[model samples]
Target: MHSPTKRHALPKSNVPAVQPTPATTTDLTGFTPADSSLRGLVGGTPVLRVSQPFTSPDRGFWAKLEGFNPGGIKDRPGLHMVERARARGDLLPGAPIVESTSGTLGLGLALAGMVHGHPVTLVTDPGLEPSMTRLLTAYGATVDMVPAPHPTGGWQQARRDRVTELLARQPGAWCPDQYGNPDNVAAYTPLALELAAQLGHIDVLVCSVGTGGHSAGVSRVLRQLYPGMRLVGVDTVGSTIFGQPARTRLMRGLGSSIYPRNVAYEHFSEVHWIAPAESVWACRQLASSHYATGGWSVGAVALVAGWLARTLPRDTRIAAIFPDGPQRYLETVYNDEYCAEHGLLGVRPGPEPELIGRPDEKEVTRWTRCTEIADPLAPTVRTESIEGGRAR
Candidate 1:
């Protein structure tokens, strides 16, 4: 077992920690004749300073609270992709918009559809939260759940296959191929600008890698402003994005079974793979301490960011992105029964991650970090070894 000294460090914040608050609806702004739609509420999210349990009070990171948006971080891409497609005459007015999403993007698409006057269809897997399913449906989106994982590519590919079939049946329908679409990466420019404006100077950026859109997009813009800024990518343990073999993943909104073309492999200085149990611990810690937390991606990202804060210089300014709020995770991450059933309860992660020289050095099964980054799709001497058995 790993040492727990650093992991159990006490909080240094002067303010007392508060319990997480339940969700509520305080806004009921009328959409009068002179008022515009809700598209204006997509950006301008707040940033929270995360300290204490995650990191020492003197060493904390800034978390971009994307949950403040109408949907989540993907709302920027979902709306931008559709808007760009419409401008290029690719998505005609009143046409159907079909795409594959885990959950967050589905909400964004539903919002985009209502804003732009299009019918949206989302293909997802059975692992999606029931609350998320109901919310997407309530937002006027047709949820198509894939029954099983693909033989090789997993649920992501299965959803893509279903989307292909849906597109074949509907004419003039547009599917925002977020995995390969450049618009998804471009959509995060505004977010990067907001971060630069909010923090003045960012020394390091930490992001969760799912479709690889936000990480690549945000880093691209931020690097232009702060050329020396380092980018750290956080992914789930079973994710194939960083060259590990694809396996069944419990966490969503981060990690991928297949390599997404949007991943800016060269931009990442290092990558960390977090386990589901570790994420659960971090999520609960954030809730009880900071009273502000998110789901899988958020938890995983926070874990990595907290480590960076403890190890890096005190002057280092690290910014981590929290994709969505914890409301959708009530049935899973926050549910005691569900966590116990999954063997995630009472499991605390070590302070430091196991370090590796390369991503394909060995099949990582727990919290691991790699400094040498390479594209799994690119040709290399180790590619043969990875294909032979290392990745399996």
Candidate 2:
């Protein structure tokens, strides 16, 4: 992987600064604009204020409900990337869209394929849920399972390798490498705009880091409006995205074994690495206490957001991005036996993580607030293995 230094995207402030129109709602007549078009329904998801289960009303935050989209948060990028490519003539009509994904992006690509009159082939791994596999096929995406992990890089790399093979075999195949694509970062502009209109002003933005699309895209736009707003990044313990060594990670949809090109490390003010058990606990708390919840990344982001809401001043208005709903996690995160089997039920986040240096710095590990941000892969940086949650 190339050092993050090789590619640095300058932040642009030219995106729309419009006030948010009131969120549309469907009346009993059921003729709302959202019902008028499937594409319109992809966005315009609600940003609901959350208070309970974790934080008091005064300390509560708002949640951007991305599950309202048919395919989850990645749907924004899936369509944007495909449309952008088509406009540039990069994606010829009927070209096959092939890319590697875990699940969310697979659904997004499948949706894109459906709307743009093209076939999509998603390369994933054995860890993909049967439910998601069926969902992708239902959306007309051909699923290719990479049979094994790569010798050095694990399932993610293996899946990428398979995508390469498929792309080579298929003519005019376009791979919207979400990890490296600028469009993925650009796709969340409307989301940030929506939050801006809804909140009027935001003090903080909390998001999980997957391909780093939503966080990077949303924060960049929000920062233009609320320059003082803090951007908090959430990640799984084993992810190298924040300079941690690659270890077996239980949670998906956030964090990465590979340092993705899309992560805007400099944009983040601070980052949190949450354990699977901690996320499991948070997820259950949301489900039981508030009847609002999501998968691993959702729980992890909520945990941090809840903490921020509780600790920040009462006047602080925080917004946490919930990637998708809990439907995908029912077999794992929401399952008591699975939680107990994995020793996740009663577990909590690890001891307060050490804050080290600026996110771009190489020496940063565990956690650290630094003055100057540096390359995450700097030679001076040494990565320590972060263990997964032990079975209780």
Candidate 3:
């Protein structure tokens, strides 16, 4: 009989142990422990190479693990937007900072609030994970949940309405308005520079589109360095951001119910709409194989990046941004029961995406790709109207 395969174990450390230092008196090796030091920890995240299972053995992509930052990728934008607002006198000192978020940005805003001495109030909907709500409160952010979604715009718009109400009630309050803010798109310049330094060259950059911040920001900066680089945008099946009809979206961190003005539609070479099941399969696969995974956005982007690795020229270098880690998804994406309840378990994405010519082609319901991207809000494009014939 064949011997049972042995499980690999980590090698024991050989370095001699040093005596523990007291927290009050110990000197940090490379880090300075100060209130201001927290903001300093927001960037310089490392990149990881993912191969095999996710991609062919000889082909892979570089993933910028933005989860390494204190509060994930948005920490960069959260701090930058707040800083710029203060500098421009748009936000007064010690003023209340109000904004709407699904979850990820709430954490970032909380961090920004603590760092900048501002009070943060995040408006969200019922879909936000319980862990995130508690964590935001723990971080000293006031959490406000909208009672219901808007008649046409859904939960995102409902949260926005609540933000407006809150802003009106509080004097000297400022909202980040991440969906349309230029600063949000500009905040990822450092991230793009980091990717260029880490990968040397990037042939294709894949990103998930929510507010269209990071994708637009990073690609804009990277294109300046590598003019020939291609940008691939990933969105959920139900997101209206890519011209799909608005529907309930299960996944968060990416996919918007509204057409965010920050989306650089002209920059995209193609866009993919991924379903919840496909994202679940990808997330699980990444966790089991590479031991590095994130929530919906990460999974969707990875699925697209892996396909690109397999189909693109052998010499092509692809970079995917993982917006955040899996710690916040314990109740949903990573939970077996939750997956079963939502019919998101045991379904594998097709090796190749179904192709379409335009973003509005037949309302994509699975892993579908489109090359002809356009701003759905553009006057030339024909988009269905909502709320008594008002164009969304």
* Model 1 clashing-pair count: 0
Query: Cα RMSD (Å) between model 1 and the true structure?
Result: 14.0
**Preferred candidate (TM-score higher): 1 or 3:** 3
TM-score, every prediction? 0.88, 0.83, 0.89
Task: State the weakest 10-residue window (summed lDDT) of model 3.
Answer: 383-392
Candidate 1: tens digits of C-alpha lDDT, residues 1-392: 87666656786998988989999976668645433558888889999999989887788999999999888899999999999999999999999999999999998899999999999999999999999999999999999999999999999999999999999999999999999999999999999999999999998899999999999999999999998888889999889998999999999999999999999987888889999999999999999998889899899999999999998888989999999989999999999999999999999999899988778789987899887778899874221121121221
Encode model 2's per-residue lDDT on 206-321: one tens digit a residue: 99998989999999999999877778888887777876677777888998888898888667666777888888888887888777789998888888888778777788889999
Winner by TM-score: 3
Q: Top lDDT: which candidate number?
A: 1
RMSD of each: 14.0, 18.2, 9.4
* Model 2: colliding residue pairs: 20-197, 354-367, 355-367, 355-368, 356-367, 356-368, 357-368, 360-374, 361-374
Judged by lDDT against the true structure, how good is candidate 1?
Answer: 0.91
lDDT of 3 by residue, 162-241 (tens): 99999999999999999999999999999999999999999889999999999999999999999878888999998999
